[model samples]
Target: MKMLINVPETVVSDALRGLAAAHPDLTVDVEHQVIVRRDAPVAGKVGLVSGGGSGHEPLHGGFVGPGMLDAACPGAVFTSPVPDQMARAAAAVDSGKGVLFIVKNYTGDVLNFNMAAEMAEDEGIQVASVLVNDDVAVTDSLYTAGRRGTGATLFVEKIAGAAADEGAPLERVEALARRVNESSRSFGVALSACTTPSKGSPTFDLPPGELELGIGIHGEPGRERRAMMTSREIADFAVNAVLEDLEPTGPVLVLVNGMGATPQLELYGFNAEVQRVLGERGVTAARTLVGNYVTSLDMAGCSVTLCQADDELMRLWDAPVQTPGLRWGR
Candidate 1:
């Protein structure tokens, strides 16, 4: 595997150190593998925490800041973070209001976060959780019992985090998070597979002239593989899958996310096609995000996430957010 790294085992640790160095506003607990805002335990606000495997950058870690997550625990590459990391992060960020855990629908993530929630309760910290299972790709995958969580995770964290930042109660935040999941749906198409650091090879194989549809973020087997197709065709396939599941009306939030290796140039093309498809379906994209927010290591592909939006959800989405990965507004 041709990667710029001193050692495979220390890649995650080294990257965490680099992230802390680059963003001083965030604090990295190297010992416990948790990243949180420097000014954590925000007085009366409910804390928000989420985590998963480490390959997807700017996800659980880069999202720690004022209007998003309070803390993020990162695990080894493509592996779930342990419960201790989650418990410590919850303890560090809880400031009386309580803490909410936003977990994806992976088996390991669900189990680990549940254990952490119990541990936090034992320590006198009230906790709530929301599980995101928005990927309409497949009902069950290698790491999950149901649909695997994908791009909608960003929507959940941002919108729900905004509510939490505004001092919404833990139960309310959890409710909003769940609502976002219910309203969102995602579909992915992969032109290539990602190479995990430890394995030092592509997680799966795809012929040069084909792509995998309904792919998971962790490089799990998608629903099917098909011959290479045009951008319009790919966009139609992805957007249609989400539309079939959601059938959203009115304003919606659209995210055209690059898997990893897909260039911004290609992503914009995909975005245009996505907009076209949504327009044809009478769904207007009031808010749109295009680029690499969630990704595999070096996979070349993209995923489309559609969230049915309302006035309240849009207002929260437009709220000020200051985080390493996504920052805008005041």
Candidate 2:
């Protein structure tokens, strides 16, 4: 349960400082808790903004760059950022073309971003919003009313960011973001609970030889916990859960995401089983991404997200992106 931070009180601030030092292309405002791409307010392009709790590294913050988020507001660990943070981010990134807020389905995130959108509009900066509720695991969770946002947050950000980078207007960018979210579904399985910096202990009770299926990113209680299963078994259950909900007829973009602490070796192996299951189900994978994208703090598990893709979505997914966490074709 030991954490590396000097103290729990400054965990978020300390991480921000380190992130600032590590990535010069991002304008990291440690005090205000806003991370923005250095080249923000790109002329004639719709701005993209997203954010959430601090536990998930390389998410909203790490994704600020070309073909992704223009600005991100990092909140306290497992907490939502204030409206001022999002409003400031919106103002900083909004060019004449307006901004789109990509919000996850957590109640706090939804409410705060909604308020921020109003605040931005009050300042004469047009703003649109897309809510992501792609988690097929649960209808309601500890932090959300509907399905909690998980892996597909990455999908929405990447595809919508590509569209925005291509000079799509606010309405189009917003529409594309919503479409990506609607087209994606996710299922997470946790082998172990994550320890928050403040708690210095596991967030939930997950005994040895047990695993939680459909776990939320914050270690929220999931569908069920049972004796630990093999990667192939877990993959079968996770992939089937998504397919049942997604019912995707066309090829899909697959994301085999680690829950922070799962090693790449295990994730890649899990991805193979996931691909096997999809193939058996007659589902084609247009593209497959492995490793951690959206994650819990240090949980030992993985999530599978499937985004039913059309030619346009696939093209956008293939677009060049230069972000700290996800980079390709740049």
Best by lDDT: 1
Collision count of model 1: 0
TM-score, one value per model: 0.99, 0.99
lDDT of 1 by residue, 85-198 (tens): 999999999999999999999999999999999999999999999999999999999999999998999999999989998989988999999999999999999999999888
Q: Give the TM-score of candidate 1.
A: 0.99
lDDT of 2 at 271: 91
lDDT of 1 at 244: 90
Clashing pairs in 1: none
Q: Count the backbone clashes (under 3 Å) in each candidate.
A: 0, 0
Candidate 2 C-alpha lDDT tens digits along 1-330: 877879899999999999899999999999999999998889999999999999988788988999999999999999999999999999999998999999989999999999999999999999999999999999998999999998999999999999998999889989999999999999999999999888888989999999999999998989998999999999999999999999998999999999999999999999999999999999999999999888899999999999999999999999999999989883
Candidate 1 stretches with Cα past 4 Å from truth are: none
